[model samples]
Target: MIDVILADGFSMLTTTLILEALRFVNLAHRRKAFDWTIKGVQSQSPRASNGFTFSAQRSFEANAEPAELVFLNASYFPDAAASPELLAWLRNA
Candidate 1:
């Protein structure tokens, strides 16, 4: 499973492209080659720089099991959205 950690003002285009690539791989293999979940650093629904909003499965929690792969999508002043909890989670991950 893959975890996509979204930050406020993330790049929508980049995120979608990554998702589509994974989907393509699954289609080519004719199996569930990859499974992914969207997670937020602070808000459950993080807004992109283009003003598009994405509904994340959940917020990053300390107890949550880390995924095999992780992607951090952020743009435009990402530091503003960084929290201690998120930093800790990333460090432990």
Candidate 2:
């Protein structure tokens, strides 16, 4: 799994849980700035820094790390949506 460790162990945990839940349905995700979208949920573009892992580790002894998951984008997804209902609409279309 790709990891984008920004900050806040709690937030990271939440992101991890959501990430895993989406994976079960074979979710396709991508990043562009902070523009994030999911098939069946509110679209929230998480802001993560590219230098979190190495830099944060050395700087603040962070618990999370940042890795490239750029390929996980809307274009690769099977019908994009801000929400699952929207995904359903996309499928129908």
Candidate 3:
């Protein structure tokens, strides 16, 4: 499984491209080749720099399970989205 951490003000284009690429891989394989979860600092959806919201599957937690791969999506003012909890989680991950 892959975990995509959606920081506030994340880059919509980059995020979409990554997701679509993964989706295409699965489509080409004709099966669910990869599974991923979108995570955010909060349970609510994370807003993108373009004023769009993307639904997050879950919030970051200290005890959350680590994925085989992880991607952190951030854009403008990315440092603003780095909470201590998130930093800790990333460190452990």
Leading candidate by lDDT:
1
Report the lDDT of model 3 for residue 46.
88
lDDT of each: 0.87, 0.31, 0.85
The candidate 1 region of ten consecutive residues with least summed lDDT is: 81-90
Residues 57-82 of candidate 1: C-alpha lDDT, one tens digit per residue? 99877678789898988777679767
Q: What TM-score does structure 2 among the candidates reach? A: 0.22
Error of 1 at 39 (Å): 0.9
List RMSD in Å for every model shown. 1.2, 15.6, 1.2
lDDT accuracy of residue 13 in candidate 3: 95
lDDT of 2 at 72: 24
- Sorted by lDDT (best first), the order is 1, 3, 2
Instruction: Supply the global lDDT for candidate 2.
Output: 0.31
Candidate 2 lDDT for residue 12: 37
What pairs collide in candidate 2? 29-72, 29-73, 30-72, 30-73, 39-83, 39-84, 40-84
On a 0 to 100 scale, what is the lDDT of residue 57 in model 2? Answer: 20
Write candidate 2's Cα lDDT for 39-84 as tens digits: 2112233222221221222211122232333122222222332345
Report model 3's TM-score to 2 decimal places.
Answer: 0.91
TM per candidate comes to 0.91, 0.22, 0.91
